[model samples]
Target: MVSLPEELQAREAAARQRMEELQAEAAELAVRLERARADLSRWEITRETVVQVLAELSAAEAVPEVVARDASDPKDAPAPHGIGVMAVPPWREGLVAGVLPDVYRDIVEIVADAPGPLQAKQIVPRIRLEATTAKIEGTRGKLKRLVERGWLDEDTPGRFTLARHYGDTGRVNSR
Candidate 1:
């Protein structure tokens, strides 16, 4: 008993209402997404803090043991007059390699093999990459990051050497 125009108008009004409902649902979803992003950011910060604390604790624990062992064993002590006669074993190359990106590993390899500290320019050719300025700069950045992470030492300005703990010999210290 409904007229045609009335039926069409009713359908149009229902569609409009449905559209409004969908818009509300979308707004709610947007708010949830924002909350999830904030939560993820918070979790990332917490994880970083936990990791740092654990590392510091582990290092602190290691020092006392090393010191005690060295004090008990005369052979373990450093040579007289501040000289270190024993070649301290290098850190595990595989361990270092596993954490590094390919470019960074390559840079480490190049530096480790060098007879002396190398400048960024000197390292580029040994890596066998196209010697573009960008590549050189990127290599420099990786070197700086490695130094920051204690993987390498800046022996002189703009030149780098492997840290004492990462000696070229690839031998792991028995201690």
Candidate 2:
């Protein structure tokens, strides 16, 4: 007959072995998650750029040929408005969230609605993105860009909040 202590020891050893295996698997998954995140970030940026370019071209096409010829200097051309065309403009008096690109506007709305400053990881799930390292990093980049543009304030590293001067509820003509 087997001793109880002996059986217990064997069970403990088995459990430990299983734990070690799971830990190894977890580490491998972490590596894969990182790679996937990088790819996702690249694709997201590329898609946004392409969308913006197409919108610009479409807007330019809509202009009357005479108007197009009149604005020989691109500087004199009216800036494209709506959808992907406008990058986050610097926040100013009377500026509104509607002016931002869709993703940026969503980020701002999320931050504005939050009770306090939030990290990119916290905001990622709110934006309906999977809470992955790549998503967090991509969100962090957008938050930083908003800060640079004066649309958001990063009071602490990695934590974002709406700029004080930016009105979370104000109405402005979206362009």
Report the lDDT tens digits of candidate 2 across residue range 1-175: 8999999999999999999999999999999998897888789868866985665566445634332445677766655553333356678777677756677888888887888999999998988877867678878998999999988888888888877763445333445
Q: Each model's RMSD to truth, in Å?
A: 12.4, 6.5
Q: Which ten residues in a row have the lowest lDDT in candidate 1?
A: 81-90
Off by over 4 Å in 2: 1-86, 166-175
TM-score of each: 0.41, 0.56
Each prediction's Cα lDDT score? 0.66, 0.76
- What TM value does model 2 have? 0.56
Q: Model 2 — which ten-residue stretch has the worst lDDT?
A: 166-175
Clashes of 1: 0
Expressed as tens digits, the lDDT of each residue in 1-175 for candidate 1 is: 9999999999999999999999999999999998897677567557755764555444444433323454777887544433442111233444454334445667777777788899998887887754656557767876888887766789798999877663455422222
Give Cα distance to truth, residue 10, candidate 1, Å: 93
In model 2, state the lDDT of residue 119: 94
Which residue pairs collide in model 2, if any?
none
